[model samples]
Target: MQETGSADPFSLSGVIPPTITAFDEDEAVDYDRTAAHARYVVDGGAHGVFPLGTNGEFPLLSGEERDGVVEAVVEEIDDVPVIAGVGAPSTHQTVRHAEHAESVGADGIVVVTPYYYPLDHDAALEHYRTVAESVDLPLYVYHIPSKTGNALSLDTLDALADIENLVGVKDSSKDVPWLAQAIDAHPDLTFLAGSDSLLFPGLEIGCSGMVSAVANVFPELVVDLFEAYEEGDEDRARDLQSEVYDVRDAIKYGSYMAGVKSALPHAGFDAGPLRSPLRLMDEEDEEAMVADLEALDLL
Candidate 1:
């Protein structure tokens, strides 16, 4: 981790991919395939690449393997900020991962709130505080209530914002009003929209950018939305936004990573199927996804 002084850790710019992690046919972490996916997205125009994020199957990998992936991606990326996602149910493990990320060349760390069991306000605060204090690098609080069973409440955020190293947040909910209010209340805080379909409306308020899983397959589309908006081309921005929205709808029908992985090969990359318990789609579902992509001429 870069030495954190008074510098702001919140960097909200560009198309950042919560990139897809690939596994070989034997179900091992395919570093080459993972790096290839990262390169493909970056080459397609992503500002940076985030690995081991939720979309990258963070929960599915072992702790040691997670570190390996972070190290490999950092080595491969060279200059792009490789925001490593490092959070766990336990405070000690979370800190350990954060320290490991620091030892490597990770640009930042993304911490998800403890899940599997509900956390009260105090517990959540302590959980984040411990992790934040363990490293000198920027820490991004991940707020995805749908999967975590807990939202990063305003009260919790207020406390976290006080942490010297606490940089920003990645809000995955579709709640733009609440996110805008949060960004307004904390002007120093960098807010990243985690949903691609919400990117245009999000920037209209105060969100810096997005950490989109859809960028795994369509990085240019997401980046264009950001660029057009910045260039004052609202019409072009809306057009790109609509295209990604249509693709987003297709991925939501089933496992998103699985759907995207299936499309990757069609897009001319061999992103194999997902791990166990997250099986490849049945033939019918696969056909449905193909039909949707074909409709958009993406296939």
Candidate 2:
């Protein structure tokens, strides 16, 4: 088994938001607001920060913009670990991002599965192997099949476990059986539940932490849930989980992935606008969402 020390970056636990990339009104990346948001979550008790993940609009931003966001967050956060997302469709591009993340002093890197192309197990192993070999930092495999269209099977995971620097996985698969089985099968690799809906269940099943999108706007709620669980207050943790479900439902009132950006202003920070191709909530939807949040006393 690959032993992970308590001081290792892979020991990351608790709530880590896949932070949203703030953009100006004209849709340019806003580094100031973006870094401020990172500081907000870390100050609110997030264990770490993950910039340029799905919520951060990684695919929408150019490579330069992505590096800028990482640099800004790394510069702002001195206490918490920053695990920048460096996944791309090809091995070449993914390596470049991973190298840049290391160059900028990011604590770790999360590489999502290669997407857009259907890959065989051999191809998948090679892709991860090449990237893992290119960097010295801890590497966490990002398995979000719904978005990536490429899934990592347990057999392939077994192969990946042999890579020296490959330390953990952040699974957004939402398949409890798969997650549980993988956890059971690979005691050497740490697992993080990447979906908000499965936070409690994931903890129950052995996920060391969570990557909650809802944490972007409501870090305390998620952090409280994690702390409650860690402190052995299961009742409070369950209650918080129920509250998270309600918040999640309310956020879905708008377009896909727009809730966090829209709800930011209500939470006292304006992440500006999301890039094109993803729109914000309309007036009616925004009002309804605000009403729900108000009812929950989140506003």
Candidate 3:
């Protein structure tokens, strides 16, 4: 599972969602079902698939379960790179996960900034530096301020830019100006917008692409936007952006995964319930999402 120094799959740049790991009624990882979903996504048109990410409920899964999910995804996906999400509160444990991912043949490791304890810019930089040095494979710095409370400051990114193993980043902060700043600071580094709706805006600001959650439900829509933008079809791209805005308004808020998972059973996918402590959608919320999807003919 060691990702050698062949080519950096960490050079992420597209609508690649950290996929939702589907489980059966018994709350077990549905490897066959999930792998089929992975194939569905690759065929639907996405640059890659990320397993064991925040959306995949990384914290809820045991290390062995995480490895199983990664292995299943890698097996299903053809050329689509699988960037394994290996973030944790402990740096040592995070590095261990990263090394495990590398050992399991993952294309790259997506390490989110450690949360719980508020670490300053230097400490944040050092945490990433330590993980990057721990493995020879490329690293993708995941910056989600709302979740981690440890934002990747412009100064910190500037410092980490010098690390050879740190190839790119997926910024989920939703701070467009800050994302722009990261692109400005490191013109060579890959800056992927973690927000699906911001793909066009990120691209306009020189961002390579996105690590979107919506792509799990609407891969073709996001991929269409990227294709249109690349083809210089601004009108088509703008229309896709409008679709994202509408979809985000419907399902991106509150228990987003539950909303999406609720929609899945309707879409002919047997997506089971969410794990405990995280409840599934209530009647009212489920109705709203279904209505939205129905309006779009997605359900």
Candidate 4:
């Protein structure tokens, strides 16, 4: 809502990485390395950077830590949009996070739907309306039902599109039909594909951009894919999509959300360890992942 950056915050196109939050061996937030990772992706030709999202381990971080990560990323990357994730189980907490992001100069705020407690359509609409009105920055609804347990129905999206300052939706649902329909229904709202698996299909179906976790490690690969499609080279784009599929499989080894952090070392970045309860890859699994990357000539 606040106009603080040079880049058009609503121009949320191209490849944007949901960057990982770097932690030390002690599992504490490392602000320096966390900012460095944001710089690394932008340097790799990523169009924008999204911190404190799923890959950043937002659920495990304290509100203060989340604010710190946003400040670090906003300071480190001046040219691209930095859309910080500020969603919580409650609207009150989400508004606080959104306010902090705007104050710290984040170009926009991504609010994942309130999780844990199931809500009806009216409750969901009011929740988003409140968050959108609370901030002056562009607000993008993050629809990742698998993790949040609250899926946004098409009818709900229809209502959301009418909210002022509610600019876009990031769909990680992986339900292509649903995503395609949502995009078709709301041409005014920017739609970003939130899964690497749907990057090409998303673009083909009129997605403005992508929020890829794989880009956190191998950004150039994702960037190349996006560029190819934009340049009208369908063959090249499809080829890159195949390559991305391989990369996704290789990096997805071990526990959930662990592959990206574990594979960072191979990409010349150290995102440290996953916070407690989310274990890193074991020796055996890591070696296999390395071999998979090597087989794909990505190592």
Candidate that would win on lDDT: 2
Once model 2 is optimally superposed onto the true structure by TM-score, how far is the C-alpha of residue 287 displaced, in angstroms? 0.2
lDDT of each: 0.81, 0.90, 0.79, 0.90
Taking all chains together, the TM-score of candidate 3 against the true structure is 0.92
Candidate 4 structure quality by residue, lDDT tens digits, 182-206: 8777777778899999999989987
Residue-level lDDT of model 2, residues 129-205, one tens digit each, is 99989999999999999998998888999899888888889999998999888888776677889999999998888
Query: Model 4 — TM-score against the truth?
Result: 0.96
Which of 2 and 3 is the better model by TM-score?
A: 2
Model 3 root mean square deviation, Cα atoms: 3.9
User: How well does candidate 1 score on lDDT at residue 102?
Assistant: 91
Worst 10 residues of 3 by lDDT: 1-10
What does candidate 1 score in Cα RMSD to the true structure?
A: 3.4
Candidate 2 local distance difference test against the native? 0.90
TM-score of each: 0.94, 0.97, 0.92, 0.96
Error of 1 at 127 (Å): 1.5
